[model samples]
Target: MTQIQPASFRDAPFREAQFMPVTLDVERRNDGTVILRSRVELGEYEPNLAQAFTKTAERCGAKPALAVRNSDENWEYTSYADLKHSVDAATQWLIDNVPRGGVMVMMISNGLTAATMTFAAYAAGVILCPVSTTFGLTGGDHVRLRHVLAKTRPDVIVLESNPKLAAAVVSCAGDDVAIITTDTQTVNRRAFSLSSVLATTPTSAVVKAIANIDPENTVSYMLTSGSTGLPKIVPQSMAATAACGQQALVAIGRAADWGGVIVDWLPWHHAAGASVLRSTLLQGGTLYVDDGKPLPGLFDQTIRNLREIPIAYFSNVPLGYSMLVEAMEQDPLLRRTFFSKMRLMLYGGAGLQQHVFDRLQEFAVAETGYRIHMTTGYGMTETVTGCMVIHYPTEQVGIGLPTPGLEVKLVPQDARFAVRLRGPNVMRGYLDEPEKNMEVFDEEGFYRTGDLAVFSDANNPEKGLVFAGRQSEEFKLSNGTWVYGGSLRAALLEALDPLVSEVVLCDDDREFLTLLAWPTAHASDQPLGTIVNRLRDFNRTQQGASAIIRRVALLDQPPNVDAQEISDKGTINRRAVIDGRHEIVSRLYAAEPDDGIGIV
Candidate 1:
């Protein structure tokens, strides 16, 4: 077995911080399956999420719990004490209106109001469901939104006072369901304003409702990204949610001690973003709800926000970091302010390119003379967030190990292992879909993640696992050679660095591999010959028919969110894109490639 050596960062200064000690117990079964679990116990955790909020309120009363940018571009903060008051009032309203086990669907973005209602629903023993704003506001038939409404049968829907959202909900939701908004005037339906809900006087019933919350009961219904099919509802129990937070706290250490200020734009509808929100609240840290996204014309806001906030922890997708690296190369102040107090940096949603990772470290060393710890994790919505994370300091990019209270089962599949998770953090099953639930879990009750991984160092299990690709996305060529889409996409992105923002592989049962890519803003101006030369360089280094690309097409159009081509987390659905752009794929495979297509 060839040993994998850790990347050398001898010149980079080491900034010290406490992280969970690495400890693992491995069990290799006769069936060629390996079970890995942390020997460190989960210890004690607060199962009631409301109690976590209440504790933070009591401990950090005057501190800013949440902040959002105003129209003037200045941040407006809501103090913990004020937030607690609003939560209690909203809890009272929930108890008086919705049933104890009823569902409250929130269609709003991350903000003060969203945070207040989230904790209120927790306190009131109501299951809160948050969906992507794009489902309601983006131009489509609202199929995903309609499907969610039909599945959960929510008792109430909370949203901003936008007529578009209100009309969408009114059309899909039942008449019996109540509509709650920030303002009722703009809503065509009879809705109650959030101010009225916050004005309710808390009674003893509010306390009783809090006391009645069952940790084992479903507290939230998180929607899957629907990359493979229609979105499925994953029922998250309070125990699972609390367990995930506790696991993170144990693994990553206390964020409060690490300077607990975060600026994030990840939508709360997804697991990673929701984990950020919950973990911040549990740690008694302040969060700035960023309105800016990683897209063009919007990331400027993120840069502006970062200039003012000296954050300790930062997280974003790889594209965001790429953009940041470009901006920081030109602006020295942005780099200084960003790296000044940052202790840890995290990237997720997709595999981060090695060049992006290296560039970020270079910036960190240049700014602070030390490398900020960067890591990634492996998990899904079914697990409520990441159960396996890279907590240790290493230059190697891989999902480190299972957190406390979690067990990972690795079943061999081809050259990789199919990762299955069994943990307190794992959800019981999908909401109201028994057949689908039965299909997802193994006989021993592990959630089949459908993700593939291999040991980064096969001789050293402690080095943890590196993501190989999605088992579902791997397809065989007509020559019977299997192509791993995920890892290939990562390689393609890295090889074509600063040229293509995203690429989709398109050679399932074809003679040769081809790709559909969206070019970076800078690369868009380059001549077609430039892209062809890069592909030639890439193809020269690659061996075998499954690895080399024969043709490529650079698309001017971005991935359409409405068509399910891209998810809320900015991950492209490979199947969706191939099907949606069938015409383009055919042209790339034509007997004579068009002038627009680049051939190597």
Candidate 2:
């Protein structure tokens, strides 16, 4: 077995941190473009696997599945017949190439091969594992690539031939592992060209064989964003992904077949991206694959795409919404179509900026005359999809009440903590590491979500959960009134009212609460008096155990990347935040109590 170290993967793209988890398969990814040169045996779930596949395929057949925008957006589609045929050919291809489930590692951009391989792997019975091209794009991604490869022990590595990654892939590959190039025009070292075979393969008999496999067996392996550690190789049961779509449909107050067209790009490696694709395919929904990156250039293009297509729903990160609100406010026709037929506008990945929320609310009042459903969907790759979703018309940023059939328990995050979830969607445990697996679920088997939250209304239990920050953000003070950093952070976000991007609460057990804010663009250049007045107003109506910002320091840096302060996934390491502002923190405490004349 080969192992990759932290140093080799140190400066990886997407995340900059130490790598963890040793995947058994290291070489190839299941890019759906290949013909499986293997067997299609019904290892298990023989009873209902065909039925579920039929149902899922039938759903896909009703609508044309359009993936990748611009050039690769093949409006051309395959019916249930075609999907089955493609699956069959791909399965046969896998068997012919590397039978008996040798891992096919896929490290490519988000496009057809990355998308289609998901179904083909299930058809071929090969272990389908995909890695983020983050390493190739940014270089340091090998830390995760190494970790995933080591743990998974893949036999064949399939990669896109990009000039930048050519040297790195060769340098990083382990011996005996085959490297295949897809659509990139170069083939070497047991390499197979993807497009060449797709044009010639016969899939009729292959799809017939795949009918025997069970739905519960591992279909594909997805990795997390690895904000905390290395990206974990998360497996989803075929049943779980399908069920998640059913639950998400219910959460959105729409029929399973409600004219859904998903618009947003959240990266395919994580839960949000994969689930959106699944949800659309299962519901016969059209997916407008947005080229937006949540940053200005990409997201602006998304808005343009939305206007062209009759998008039924839009989902993205907090930054995306903030930028989108600016776009909506700028255009009148865009605003009309934005709210029209738009049943769900979902936010996940990270916290929604309060400013974005306010602008959305304001936009609803002006454009549609009624507020549309604004929601927060929550889950990890381990759960296969979001276990909870904030329902529409529910104000504030909530992860929403638990989806039907899911159970949630408030595990004490810190002394003042309250957030955890468990259910059918919970993962079937990690790849290995029993000790670590044991920590994920409790005595009752609820998945321990490390988030902190407040009951939306202390009076109303069923409303939803309001996310505070992470538990470690809690800071105690001389007063012993444990400042709930999560609650304080929420209050700061609430207090700023649609002003800041994301809030990081500062409490070192100090005398008062200080805020390290990542400001929203619209609120960027506002006057100091206006900001001070806003905080003072917030303090007026503030209540117990929550925070009242004594002072707010707007941090100019983007979300901590390079894992120096925050990881690539945007989870602020509280330690990084506090230490980075040591001197400022000291001064805040020294002047906490009436700076002039001790309250004279």
Candidate 3:
């Protein structure tokens, strides 16, 4: 038996390894403002994502690349060679149907078929667009999808076996757009079956076209969550996408002899999922598709799958990890298997509560006699996935240092610094948004992140940056004091653990702040008196209005997904929740507060 040693960033072996090199340029202006830019040396490897996948497949020809549960509830495997072949076949079909520069929008489940089509779109040189399937087929959700369809004007639209999603895409699609689905029973005469197309062989001409694809061209057009407004299309270049995958591979620090395994259910629509997909392919690792999400009804599926497969590494949002912690606490076998082969655990998208972090450490020590390294990074769709990563092992909550091929600049913004980034991994600009794009970057060419951050220590950058809310999310009180929502939310969640699932403060031009709290499952089980006492204790420890949650109304329903109150990535949109639930908020701030409202 051999012991698997984890990779450390400070090790001599790691420091000497030749990955891509990024040159950082710094300039100081007379006005005391500084600018930063990072340029990558591009001669080390192939820039095209499909070409990189092809090379990886050649290296791991017979290795299992994709695994999915079949209709008979058996795990079906697709080898690297099989995956490449399927992608090529799908690419041929896409070439015949969609012209160059055309958009191909997909509303599909996370499975082998969906993964195959995504790569095929890349190989065929069409701009692939992925939208959230969590958007149910009604009201605002439906309207939002229609807006995406209208904005992208996709030449081809692919839907999963889901009838609801198929109906939504069909209704929104233009008459000339080709509608495709995996459901054989689909009644639409014009809608083509994906299975039939995948069975065909690639023509020589189609193969030639695939080889002719520009390595630096835009391969994907990802849609923003539109939590603030309508969704914007971000065009991500092939080089940028590939750079992210390579950076992740370098961070994982697995030796060449080491292969990896993952059981992931993150939606492919988000950059997080794409990063995992690319890294898996780049490393020639096996990916087991889990059809479950972190939500109550679906998380059982994730647990069932994990019971069968042992993963080398895993990543999920804070809510998912919180739920998993509860399950692992009660089930020792689950905990043992979870930490058995795992190298690292990663969480991102929002601030992870400290209690959740502590619980994971507790379970890790109990199961494996050692604490598993858990960390997270920070980035958006604009940066492809992550620019700053915790490449080294640490339990602290900072976003970590900038990865190779990227530069992070902190500029003064209000009381905090705005995090601006420049790198090969960053997107060129949003599609059809020239003016908006112009406003995002400075003369020195750094993209404004709209995020505020403060370094853990001013003198030491190695300590990393702490997230202070988004500039757009902050609001001013009537007394002209500004409130940072992210900091407040993180503090409240940490101090009042197991009581609140989420908190959104409403204090714009108000005398005192009010909060709309979404209670955790544990909190609901407790008596109202007990919950009020917890809030009281938390408030007494705080100093000012921004820190104290004055009045709170526990939400009767979860944050509405359709109304953009909560994103698919498990992040609450504070502005959307406030706007959509104004009536409930008004009640919380009434002259005579409602009986349901609790005051500190």
Candidate 4:
């Protein structure tokens, strides 16, 4: 094992005394490149994912590491010792059943079995690939799943015992690859039970395999949903993933000695879930897998979990926090329990609205007697999880300074700057696509992030970068003003809170912005007259042409996965919105708009 270096928190990126006790060191090269790196040292380790779990297990021992609700709707706990034991057992099973250095594609949901299996694969040096369980045989999800299977060409696939997922994997895997299911009973004779594998005794061969594994080996092939094309497989090294975990711990200002708890439902298919799991495990913290999502009829499950367990750190998309705010308003007991032991509230995937941010702060202060620290970060699968995170309190939305190992360069494009990042956290390149890789990186090898951003304080890089929308999504109006879709969408979501669920900003060669919005489930109960009146009140405060919505078209159906409007991670694909629904957009500009189109 390599001796871990001590992190230097003295030179943190932000104003040291204002926020979390974390800092970074920024240096400028003579070649006009600025480099930002984390000052916090990651203490000694073997720089392997499996080694991380082994050390955490020894330290945490009998402490609870994971919690999941059983079929009976009760919490079942897994201690660190139990986790290590299970991982070892499962590791031996993989060694026996799978060829060395094979791919282990996971198609299971968030649970004890799924979590253990993923770690066990890493321990045995299998490349872990997780696919969203929501992906079906049809739609854009199917296209993504197929792309993943073709790229990784997995040696084995793990999934729930259900027929739906079984069929999906089988269709993608064909007859060559082995299928492992969680069911005890065999519905498909070819499918092996995951329990049978877990029952295998530990072998020295597995131990030897773990010792021989290389930190530079690709540990995972995380799929990224390209905004313009099919999902791309990111070959992530063991060292990169582990480094990301350390960065996460530093970004949150978490002490190794003070282990915390997290309640999360984000899918393992995405980088966010993997980052959270790795960070919690490395910090010896507990993770309670909440099955609830931000979508309608699902957030209640999250509320139920929160009502029972006190979370120290909370992470979610802006939409999830919005739903949570609505729930907290209705239930006083929930408000108290949710914020009882809260340390930090983190939002990602997109910029949060000012209204939603303010509401959460109010609730936290009322319940916890003070305003809790609310922060956000910016990164993608290419960066493992986050390259830049806000470590301190900010007045508005700004992704905080770069962590210890990353280098962020801002290249001028349009009115804003396109963010280019390079570090251990970033992937080496896209799998098997040399041309695509060339297009994404510059002459200096910084990965070109398609998104644009602006520094919050031009004089002070420590203040961080404000996300300016995706480059492809931005379009010019007839008046020649470029409208940033991401910022506009966030503003509309805030102003139309509790009424609009999602918004797609459409304008190119048009006089003003056209909003194609999906009403909240609650909005379905209100009359069209009521909905239009609410928009009228929201528009009254707006000043500029870029901010004004000349026509509002209420969508009868949500963005469809088949049409490519909804990505596999459930985020709206902005280009798909305009291209998929050209008819709806055209109607908004008709001489006499339809009843569904409200003229402002």
Candidate 5:
């Protein structure tokens, strides 16, 4: 065999080789699936979360891994040793409660039943179908529960021990699946309580689960309630979760008292908890659970928590940042307290506006005598959390390149072929939906990310990637000229400043592209004409026939909620907006000055 020497960049022969520039939204190809042949100790992995707790109990598992609100309103965390014993006892009780391998309807309040046992089941080696207790509150919730029951067909439905809530669960489950209650009491529901399960005979029944179960063992299933169509059951695996944990930890750097104290209230059913919690747990680190949302009334509490934690890394959807910027600009100690611990402040799960980034830069420099790293990460649940994370300095606004394990490909999308990615972090498939799964991954096995991106610094590929926009939303006019809604949106936002929080580009079949500008609710002081004039200025920056936006409206209505699928990250759901805006879009196409959008 021919001897091949190691590859090094220092060699002149490799100096000319081109690597993609890094940007906030861009993706780059870098080989494929990773195999750790060299035992370089990349780090520990709870490949099967089932065995993770046992491993942690032997190591740094908290005295109580499960947390609960005390009578005094303080949140207390449970240690690992006790949690393990509880899980084992619970497993033995559940086995006697329901048949082996039978599905269990897991739904209750946002407490332990929602967060812990649910996770415990996966670790305890049972199939747990997680559902929302909120589904029983509204007509929509009932309808959703019906849809879920038909699909999962669980042998047992577990309701939180709250008596009132247990009654709802029993009524929902009916005579079909047996109901098991936790801690709370429910009327008319014949069931076993988790507390009773914990007090099971033979307290040491041994809850140790088989760690090497088939990857597709169907541990946890989450339904996607996206606006577009019927919900999807996104089945999760040990591989994907473990992969996501490793990927995020490598990039974010995890260590106790070292990593950021993420004070987010994002739902655990989504990717945020999966990626964030998995990474933190793998490092035996701490995760501060926040109870508030990003809304105005809730902002102060979050700010207080944020100030106290000294976050090393923090992320919020764009709207959250817009508000954070306001609160940050108003306070001095908050800035000192914030930047004091915040090393990397990231934004994602939606499109980020430039003005928010600028405000962050101002706050960081003025208070800390340092610049905070403002960045964005892009990935789908299928892609194990995030495959690409751009940690560009506050000054740069682009999403950066992919980490070492991923690969990207961009085909024009228009007459100009654009870039995209194919990587291992990409999902295996959407549970049992082979037909749907085939479309997501190309023949080469790369996940077809619907996002469009450009080179942050094309001259040097390694610099990073920039988020261009949704490829599906980019279009052209009768002039045979292309309108990059994303590129143009970026330009308009840069010029419009912070007052204009979000913009939806219109005019699909019309002559010039239009906009439905959602001004910042706090930006009431800015006049409509000023924002319009700024749009005109932004349009002027474009050259040739592509420059457009004959009319613009500042919408009083916030972005669509259920009907319009604005991303959880706060990016405008272009397709949802265009679909729902049949009339609003019509007026914009007709150049109706009374656009659904308006200036502050």
Candidate 6:
């Protein structure tokens, strides 16, 4: 067993930024329940998302509101004024067609048009439901798409002009639902062109619709990842969405200055991506909709985009940061362009490995003589994005304290605490699911997050909290030893660095633990003996049965997005993968293991 060194960022200069002062109000109940809230009052925020966009448009009409890569591989910019006009026209069309408060399902990818339609739908008082394009594009059966359609019962379905999507929509959507495409050519009888919608003359009705928007009214029906079961629809209100942005502002301050540039590829269907979109627009910043992703084939486009566009703020999942680190390590020009103007680097969706954080700091120090401030936040679809953030400067990874206007309740659960939240940003309940609503909230009206956390410094309440794992994912073995899946996964990832890209723990009700891992790209070139030796080293350091890995199997295939084994945000659906790949799990726990299984 070897001693692991603690991360030290003292020598590295942290990039300067305006962070709002944090003052937490902590209350310890007689029953050992702890309540945490920020004392710094949340200032005024926009009443509705429509008003926010309108205000930004008026403030910076000539500034680029959104940009997308054209077919020629050059960015096509859309000014705030131009986008406002388009949104007004689209709003007028929606007022004429769809009933007020009707749902409009968006199945389109991120682009200037998608951005326009999103705000237009908000301004027109139409509840927007943005779903993953993979639902319609991939998975031959379109099971999830049909399920979403059934749940939403949308009046209009808007998507990019693709024959496959058109066919899928026609098959799943009701005949009464109108289908809109970007192009003028319609593939189905009920289809309409986005061009026609945008060509509609803006009347006083559009202005009136925008003015009539209520902060309490539902703005969007955000869908959960459905990792454990079917995707649940979370109805986000205008006030909640706006409050999320204000929370970020008061907690971590602005990611960039006014009119700053942001390049991102996070899908708009997810809460984090939606927050990024809304926050950027509200702050009067330019958002360049990135077409690239963190996947192997698509990440190259991300590198290309970063090379061309100097971003003020960058955010991605841990895996995405891992890929970026590899790219930046190889290309000096890429590092220069990426770090030249980047004020902050934020990671979410998963725990970032300490090695990745260390390497990024080294690169940052080399590039600009200052380590870019890296932070993370904790939230979900129900919260309209991150309601808790790592606002202050610190080297360690943590979930941080609750943002202003949010209350966090921590109930004792073994050594950790089960997290529950109550905030203006938090959702009232899942859409029309009274049974689930009852189960999700407690008697005090706190939204039960089902997440486990421990204080970073129990003696100091301001140090924030560290995520332990999900309560549902924690399972007891046959021997009655509980395995904290989330914390264990994070630890194993750090221990097997540069070897495994991701790992899933198994043997929930069995005697011991096993792992199914996806190898890193470089790991494939390494000898099997080397990977086995690393696992043996990690196992030797563990003292308890819960922490020990008895065997490991390298997965040949990645988590399939079409099968719902992985989410658009790159989060692995642990239950989905385990259920979907029973055979693989069985092989890992066989009585007489094969040569491929690395026994420790």
Number of the top candidate by lDDT?
6
- Each prediction's TM-score versus the true structure: 0.95, 0.77, 0.90, 0.88, 0.79, 0.96
Q: Rank the candidates by TM-score, best first.
A: 6, 1, 3, 4, 5, 2
lDDT of 2 at 583: 67
Higher-lDDT candidate of 4 and 5: 4
Q: Residue by residue across 1-600, what tens digits does model 3's lDDT show? A: 122233221121211122223334555566545444334333365677777787888899999999898999899999999998999888888888889878998877778877888888888899999887755355444777777888899998877777776666667778888877767576364778888779878988556766788978889988887877878889998888878766555554352112578788878898888777777777788888888877767788888887777775778888888888778766767877887766577788877777677776666555555666666788899999877766554556887767666777778766677888888888888989999999999777889999888766666555667787787777788988877777877887776677776788885888888778877877867765666787788888878876677788888787776667777777888888888898988898899987888876
lDDT values of the candidates? 0.85, 0.60, 0.76, 0.77, 0.60, 0.86
| TM-score: the better of candidates 2 and 4 | 4
Give a tens-digit lDDT track for model 4, residues 1-600: 121122221112221123444465666666545556667665444577787778889999999999898889888999999988888998998888787779998988888878898889898888899877655435344766777788899888887767766666666665778778767353343667777877889988867877888999999999887667877889999998888776666556462212677788887778988877777777788888888877667789999988887766788887788788888778887888887777678788776666566677666656644666778888899999876888766656887878767778877665677789988788889999999898999998999988878878777777777887877777788999877767777777877776777888876789888788887656778876666676677678777777778788888876676666776445788788888889999998888888878887
Return whichever of 1 and 3 wins on TM-score.
Answer: 1
Instruction: Give the per-residue lDDT of model 6 (tens digit) for 292-329.
Output: 88877888999999988888788888889989988977
lDDT of 1 by residue, 1-600 (tens): 121122434366666666788999999999889999999889987899998788888999999989998888788998889999999999999999999999999988888888889999999999999988778887667888899999999999998778887778888888888889877876666689888999999998877887878899999999998877779999999999999888888888553242278898998878888888888877788899988777667789889888788887888888788888778777878888998988888888887777667777777776776888887888888999888889887878888899999999999987789999998999888888999889999999998998999998988899989988887888999999988878888888888887878899996899999989888766867986787788889889888988888889988787877777877667788888899899999999999978988887
Q: Please tell me which model should have the higher TM-score, number 1 or number 2.
A: 1
Worst lDDT 10-window in candidate 5:
9-18
Candidate 4 C-alpha error for residue 121, in Å: 1.1
Position 571, candidate 1: lDDT: 77
> Per model, how many backbone clashes are there?
0, 49, 0, 12, 58, 0
In model 4, which runs have C-alpha deviations exceeding 4 angstroms? 1-46, 137-141, 184-189, 255-258, 476-483, 494-499, 507-513, 520-548, 556-570, 576-583, 589-591
Point to the candidate with the largest TM-score. 6
lDDT (Cα, tens digit) per residue for candidate 5, span 337-425 = 87775666667755567656656765665555455556677776666566666633324666655655565666554433354465445
Q: Decide which is better by lDDT, 2 or 4.
A: 4
Clashing pairs in 3: none
Runs in model 1 deviating more than 4 A are 1-10, 255-259, 478-481, 507-511, 521-526, 540-544
lDDT score, candidate 1, position 330: 78
Compute the lDDT of residue 320 as modeled in candidate 2. 71
Runs off by more than 4 Å, candidate 3: 1-43, 184-189, 253-259, 478-480, 540-544
In Å, residue 386's CA in model 4 sits off its true spot by 1.2
